[model samples]
Target chain A: MSGASRQPNGSHAGGVPHDDDGVPGPGEMGGIPRGPEAPAPRPPVIHALRDAGLAALVAAGLFVPLVGLRTDVGPAGGGLILRTRWADVAILVALVFTGRLAMNLWSAFRPAKRPRTALRAAQLTRIGTFVAPLFLGFAVLMPLLPWTTRYGLDLGVLVLTYVMLGWGLNIVVGLAGLLDLGYVAFYAVGAYTYALLSTTYGLSFWICLPLAGIFAAFAGVLLGFPVLRLRGDYLAIVTLAFGEIIRVVLLNWVSLTGGPNGISGIPRPSFFGLSFSAGGEPGSFADFFGLEPSPTHRAVFLYYLILVLALLTNWVTIRLRRQPLGRAWEALREDEIACRALGINVTNTKLTAFAIGAMFGGFAGAFFATRQAFVSPESFTFIESAIILAIVVLGGLGSQLGVAIAALVLIGGFEAFRDFEEYRMLVFGAAMVVIMVWRPRGLVSTRRPSVALGERKAISGDLVGEGHG
Target chain B: MSAPILPARNAPILQVRELLMRFGGLTAVNRVSFDAMAGDITAVIGPNGAGKTTVFNLITGFYKPSGGEIVLNGPGGPKPLHATVGHRIAQAGVARTFQNIRLFPGMTVLENLLVAQHNTLQAATFFGIGAAFGLGRYRQAEREAVALARRWLEATRLLDRADDPAGALPYGAQRRLEIARAMCTNPVLLCLDEPAAGLNPRESEELAELIQLIRAQGCSILLIEHDMGVVMRISDRVVVLDHGVKIADGTPAEVRADERVIAAYLGEGDEDDVPAAPVEGAA
Candidate 1:
């Protein structure tokens, strides 16, 4: 019980005391100077130019080697020679200068007031109800559209995979308030499970899917046992180490996992018992349907399959949010001390969150393996974990729609810039910085409570902790 | 498991015997002993750092005593709490509030009470599947839980702000909500640490009335308060502590008359010595 007692400083620290008289603080006064005597003073243009010039210089220095300079081996197996992409450097420098200039102007002229949470909540509700459905409908019809190319289908699959991963991570990090930096480990477990089971035992995709989720959940439980007492950054660091351990094990375990060569020619999921193969056995999808074989059929089927799984994940998560366990998860987030005082078993609550979140990651990983028809340690890297985490953060933690939107904007946007090659990551990094600055909490920061007693007003994210459990 | 043992009638609901707790070289609670009778309001009063909270932490299983036993007398005789954890102690029918209010600030006022009844609803929810499916058993439990929460809210005069976040309530109201939340566990014994610490005069008066009401509703109360007025008016028995040791224990009038109790509060100086009767009235 002494161990069960909350960390003494944990609960009460950083709590904003409620003022009985309802007088707003200086920062909450709509950002307008009250009882002001002085007129507004804008920054001088020369100052703005100086700030922009500094930004340009820094940008030039950073990009000159990474983007501006490239080393190339001489044509025939000769010594290396320097190759410069001056155009790339100039484009980057100009972008930085213009961005800095705009920021300076906006800082000087933009309204001092923070946007009203009420107005933002209303706008989000409108978009959530109207625009969100339209986007979902477009996703549903994406493969069926007349103009869809194979490349578009492939990109769609990639985007959806990350979307599912982001949503899965959201359950642990966003909803449960556990900062897991090693979520990709569970994804790897699921992928490897499918790879090993289907290839060795000749299990079908349907049979192995549930097994993958279970195995990943077991891994989650194993990780949960030793780390239940840790909180915040300590918990995050352990999870990150766990992720790396899983990756390294998968890399070196050659006998079972095929070493670095990876498990390949992993079978694709069939349309029920009907294979999507062309030469068409009696049970092949095309022969059974009495149609000519087409590669698009399998691609479209895979799209629909993943769509159902992702949607099911979303549906189950939304339902879990209202349950006692879900409330316990959130309560644990708000105050673990209070939660224990309320007679909650902290260990059980945390384990459930980790296991469930990891379960979804497992399902997504299995889908990924089947889609690619390969399983490799290379795919489950720390950067992949970082990207999925970015989606959750950029979307607003604990937000379902936000995660989806973030995945689309980040993963989809990255794919859209594929032609930029090395420059794409540069743009990607810049866009991430800009978006974070624009919305620090996230793109959709307002929280919609799972249950409400009366009118369900969305709460401002300001009141919520930054995912502490 | 062994056979269940029944307790004698009219026995004390809680017993702390020879409790000893040491932190390094310092003994925070040393050889303390007390029996809080059923259906009675017992108050523990002391100077700052007299280990009043440390004692509460011991009984509620926040800390394991270095030496001693805390037993809760249930229908099945005394249950030793030395082996129990905080949540288990709560399940064994002892509940308490912190000296600093520990309400879930993010949760609505009513939700705070609902969380306190987590074990009951959690059982009905069948590990969350029943709740997810909105089964009749889960819904019924939820209805009863909400009803109980509303009832307590009404008693605490917090019904009007039931949907407001508990953290947004005034300091006094947050204290009341914390008490209400602890009561929602439906414990046989309720231990409150400094329940009147930050309350205004009117709020303290109302709190005195609420304590009586809760006691009348069949829950025994053990309170720790620095406010002598509330302690004297509401408490049927008083236990005084000084420097982690019990100094006095008796009826309010009896403890008020103890010379050691007077000396503990006042100075040990000879000139400050006075008859305890006038001091009680003055305090």
Candidate 2:
């Protein structure tokens, strides 16, 4: 009412408008105006995507091959021009351009609809769109195509596993705003849980999956207790140490984990009774089912399995965010002092975030072990945690869709460039630096902060509140 | 106004018995004792660094007392109120606002009030998964929170800006929102630190009316304010602190006329020389 009437143009009451440098200044931007209705500024995404598009075009030109080159495929009777190297280079350029274009379109259109529904649909569609290509390329198209298709499908599966891992980490780092550097510890817990359970009990992957999540949740609580009082960089260091400790335990504890040699011959997931292997019964899946027995079937199934798990993770995360616990986490992140004032048990809030986040990590880890049919300390390294954290950060902290988009670009795009092994990490690192410089908050930086109660209408003079919890 | 809702014969709602707080060699609150009745406006007044805020902090569990006890007369009568930290104190029925408005800068005004009721919301049933789908008793708690927030928003005349960030509200509105947020917990005793610190005279008078309204609702108030006009206008009783010691405790007129209280303010040579105007720079 009276307060609303006193609000500055495009500025919330008590909120001083800042220049590009973030300094508050006096002007129409900071002065109280005499009006009943003043339109709020457009959301930040539109501006970000426009800037990203211009940068993408300039980067695309750098990927053009120096010499127009070609290779021949002997399998086809005719000379099939092999532009593998140029195509590989061109794909990166194309990805950047596509990512920019997609971001621009998303930003421009996002504000036209209800933010909550649009956000949910955008999240699902983004994941769905990326996943549709995998099912088509791996399951249906690969078998009909050539050997090159098989290789591409295998690489896609591998990239997807990491993407899932990154997504799980995103729930912790992105949504909860907890800096977890030892996320791989949960991954190790899941892998080991499955490996030990399947080998010792002779249980199937399906049965071990839920158990792994529970065990990892237990482990997360264990880690959370000691670091309850810690915050910021200290918490990060302790979590990093915890990750290393898990790796060291796996490596040195030979009796349980098989130590340095690592656990081998880990069983892959089976469909009901059928297994993907040679020398099965005469009328097995290949004969009785009337389908060709190929390793690709296992790869395709695993890809879809992880894909579903990833979707579940996203769904669960979105839902949890609307809950009281989610708000508590954001509140804690904003100000522990105020959170305590609200009678929120900060210790318990943090533990829940850790436990839930780790549980998802465990699910991904179990899937990883079954897919690869192997378990090793090498897979659960600090670098893995770093990459997952990077995905969360690059996507944007506290933004679920942002993390997924980040993973798709970073993990998917990086793996797609496997042929250029030496330059791959260099390119990834450079891209990260460039992204950080351009958009310090990350690519998809707009956050739909966890609102206490339900989402309310945007009142005049107020920009969207950040959810510290 | 309405008749004061006095506590039952034998016990005060909150009784601080010889509470003492020390910072190394420096004694912040020295043997301060007070009682807040069930429904009364008890104003705590003091010169700068006179341990008024420190006493509030000690009572609200922001700081542990170096000595003495804080007892909230529960159903059992004179039960020790565990003043462990800020959060536990809030759980124990004591809510407070900072001298500097400390609303979650990123959170909306309505959310600021809702967060104050966080502990009252039931936990997630069905292994925390049910919360994701928004299926739970939390819906009822949410309704209560919204209704309470709306009531305070209307009371503060901030209903139109309910969805705005608390930090985005005007300075006076921010001050009122802080009180609204504290009230959402349905606190037995509201501890407000310098609620009138930076308000204009008109806003201060409005704040005084709001405090009286809050008291009329059966809530006991412990306020630290520098505004003499507001203090005299609303406070039923006043406690004056000087150099970590209670210099005077009586009705507002009695404390105002106390020579010791007047000397404590005027005798503090350099402090009195400084401008008596409100400090307006934002935190």
Q: Judging by DockQ against the true structure, name the best candidate.
A: 1
lDDT of 1 by residue, A1-469 (tens): 0011111111222223233445777776887765667766545577788999999999999999999889999898899989999999999999999999998988777887775455554555655666567778998999989999998998888888888999899889887899999999999999999999999999999999999999999999998998998999999999999999999999999999987899998999998789988677688999989888888889999988888888888877888876778777777878888787778888899999999999999999999999989989999999999999999999998888888889999988998889999999999999999999999999877565555455444555776656564
Task: Please report, in order, the local distance difference test score of every candidate based on alpha carbons.
Answer: 0.83, 0.73
The alpha-carbon RMSD over the true interface for every model, in angstroms, is 5.8, 6.0
Please count the clashing residue pairs in each candidate, in the order shown. 1, 8
Interface RMSD of 2: 6.0
Q: Could you report the DockQ of all the candidates, in the order they appear?
A: 0.32, 0.31
lDDT value, residue B201 of candidate 1: 71
TM-score attained by model 2: 0.77
What tens-digit string does per-residue lDDT give for candidate 2 at B123-195? 4334355555666466665676678788988888787776666666678888888898888877777888889
| Candidate 1, residue B4: how far the Cα is off, in Å | 18
Give the TM-score of each candidate.
Answer: 0.85, 0.77
For residues B183-204, write the lDDT of model 1, one tens digit per residue: 9988888999888777667777
The alpha-carbon deviation from the true structure for residue A212 of candidate 1, after best TM-score superposition, in angstroms, is 1.0
